[model samples]
Target: MPRYGFIAIDDRGREYRAVDEAMSEAALEGRLRKAGHWVAKAWEIRPMLQKGGLFGGSIRVPTRPLTEFFLQLSMQLKAGIPVLTALSGEAGESPHPGLKRVVQDLSERVQSGQTLSEAMAAHPKAFPRVVVNLTKAGEASGNLAETCNRIRLYMEWQERIMADMRQALTYPAFVLVCALAFVFIVFTLLIPRFAKLLAELNVPLPLLTQIMMRTSDFFVHNWAGVLGGVAATWAGLHFGTRLSPGFALLVDRAKLKIPVIGGLWCMIGMARFAQNLGVMYGAGIALPEALGMVAGLTGNRVLEKSITELRQAVTEGRQMHSVMGSHPIFSKLVSQMIAVGETTGSLATALENVSDYYNEVLPRQIKRMFSLLEPLMIVGLVGFVGMVALSIFLPIVSLLNIR
Candidate 1:
């Protein structure tokens, strides 16, 4: 479908201008007439390439700010403020230039007679399919305020989980980087000087020292090859994920089997799925449609495949809990609860409960992993430093004893 920009006069004699997607200019004009607007003019709008600014590219508005924007918008709507007023106020007050641009665009579209959902759909980067669908559902159900609230809560929850995961990984990442820097310094700079001194003394080296020196020499001579190999491996994996769905699926499945992080990944996926599905279902979205929308939120190919299967089964009039139980992604407890919810006619509540369960347990699991990781990393760092020190000093001590 192509977008057409139009100018029209509404039944109240107010002129409106908007860009809308339609099959042709005639179709867009017909839509405007049907909605009690007299179309003045309509033209197809083509996309233009935006040039990068001094910052090198477009500014990306982060999710936390979006969450706050929606939270405020929802409150304003709940207080009986008009959509245009809420949007204009938000755009005016927003500190993020990217968000201000999006909100201002949305306000203009809405003023031009487009629905809020339609306006948001134009900016998919800022407002995803799930948000657009929920907004559409709210428009249909006359509950846009509640829908906005749900979107805010969902984004806030997701941001918090991501923040926690990042925090948990911070110490381990720092330790790994420090260890790599230490090894690089020793191999490229420190070890060679020690090796030269040992050679001048003409003493027999210990097996460990000889091995370390040989390893350092190899690295010093082949650092280019080592760096190129690392870069090639990273590039290959990055492209593989983008180009091959099967490879991506295998990688996602393997991610769930990694020792401490795997369980956290599963929990995060489940929580997101449950929360999104619950909100959409509660807002009166059909099960199949809700399942289809929620599938994209998982960010894992394996879980997405299972959800797609579940959606197909539901479309065929099969019991959702029964179909879901066949997938390992849904735990036994979750399956049982979903079945009970379906039987009792409260599936949304059941999903919300599942989400709450994960939200509570996820933090504890992250904390436990961090507790174990800290000590393990410290011990590894100490052991590595001790080995390097021994390799360098033991030879010098032997030469001293001989003197």
Candidate 2:
């Protein structure tokens, strides 16, 4: 389907402009009319800048962490409790200030007759597109309770997978931070004190020790510059993603090329895509629509582009398996499973199976990767510290032998 940017009016001549999805210009016009908007002008916009900026900030606000909130929401909806009442309950129990306030507002909106999906869409910063789409599908299918349950389960899986990956990286990350701190201590405090004593004694330092002294002095003198460089680098990456889609794609591509971490990163993204797509499909979303919704879940630009291309191919009546097979990023197993699902009309189940498989495999893989990384990091840091110590002490030993 083609995306169009349309400026339109209602029967009473109220004007509005927005971007919409449709198969053609004529189709979009029909849709607008059906929605009670009379089309005045319509045109397609080039998707050159396809994605939004870095989501929020470094402190990740967990959007769907409260597993119990969803569970209760499902139970309430199942018991014929109104959507507003359910949202209010969720709001009352949510501990996070941001989420609590948003839920409260959402409850008010729902009470005012907006659908749950509509209420949620108002908070795009809080709710992901997949969640919003699932809510809509649930409302359309009259199975809000089941949809909420599925979404809750999906989010639980996501959080667990992420927690596992974070755990795997935790030890290595801590080691790296400690290693940097050790280096800083040596350069700033220990080395300078040693240099003072050596200067007082008028001892000629070894070449390695001389080099270390010079490096430490430079670092000590230019500490502010180092901090500024780090800050600048972060800002550049942040604004670059916001201002340039091409640059963002390059960064995302680089992420996939990273060493051991890269593979795990890719797996995490694939799991998210599979799980969200499965949930949508199971909730009776059409294949193309499901693909569109799933695209938002992948944090990588290259993968998002692949999904967009896949959606286009499917829109043209191309086989899902063939479209996906053309992309080298997708594994043979995933492609084959999709093929099987398409043939048997069970893509939902196939997607669910893929999600389940990764849910089981990724945590274990992440743990193993971390376990290997920790020792390697410790050994490297110790070797570095030992070399520096030896370089400084060996010259003293030589001077003693001369005496």
Candidate 3:
């Protein structure tokens, strides 16, 4: 019996997390559901294989295909198509091969008389627990079509935020990489040529020229060592976080403490947190359970831990705004809005407002971030080129004066 860790909400909306022995993951979920627990997450306490980051993760259908699948499924079901008919059509019509295969399997399972959610549960990688959880809520509410539509909309919004982040960072990352390559070129090739020319001139070098020439010589002689050291350090940092939760948590904290970018990261995490929690809560999930689902979605372990504790606190009947207010990581805007939402008993709408507010803030911050980064990178590149040219020129001028 493998021990599984699970977070679930009882019918009374109380959250619980415990370790229980189960024969399989599905058995744990089934047992909890049988006991009237709405499970947010469940997994073997220690997986035989560790998977983290995109490459190590299980094969997942891309968001575009999944989004389209949900949209089509929602429409067909609303038009009164049978689950079997809808899934069968989707299996054939899905543009992505990976999703098509998953849909085909889903169709077969639906044909075998399992409910759509139950069938989807069997392929957790293809249909995430969130998707299955939302579908189950849909089934329970007898509004499967509406729930699926909402899921599609949420996915679209989340994907757009991610695409925007990538678009903003992509050019900066490219420029940084190019600048580093140019620096390497100067140290190994261009600077060395100047160094040799100066040496043949046999003139006294300025202090700056002396320093740059020595740096070039060291790099030329130890290029292998320099590259190896960088590669080794990077690999160590990358794998260390994956291997140790404590270190990863520290790193997550450090990420939020970094300058201009740190504030941006916090806003993004908060927006995601509010949006996910809102969507789940709006779909009829309890707050504790919705928080359980959202804990991992914030993209920051520190925030994840805070939300996890918040889930526990809410489960214990504490006010969510009170808990959020105490955490410095949470913005006043979020805490204040949450307090208003709680007072008015429209917490879900409040959450959506929080998310909306951040969505608007994100684009402005991203543009500001770009404005800072672009000028800094340009200055850095120009500085490097100027230093190299000055270092080379100073020595030549001295050599001519001596002659």
Model 3 stretches with alpha carbons more than 4 Å out = 1-59
* TM-score, per-candidate, Cα-based: 0.86, 0.80, 0.83
lDDT per residue, candidate 2, 67-141, as tens digits?
Answer: 666788899999999787778788888877766766765665555446888767766666677888898999999
- Candidate 2 regions exceeding 4 Å error are 1-66, 82-104
Query: lDDT for model 2, on a 0 to 1 scale?
Result: 0.81
Q: Which candidate number has the best lDDT?
A: 1
**Most TM-score-accurate candidate:** 1
C-alpha RMSD between model 1 and the true structure: 5.0
**Which residue pairs in candidate 1 collide?**
none
lDDT of 1 by residue, 132-248 (tens): 899999989999999899989888888988888889889888988998899899888998988998899897798879989999999999999999999999998889988999998
How displaced is residue 320 in candidate 2, in Å? 1.6
What are the lDDT figures for the candidates, one per model? 0.85, 0.81, 0.84
Better of 1 and 2 by TM-score: 1
Better of 2 and 3 by TM-score: 3
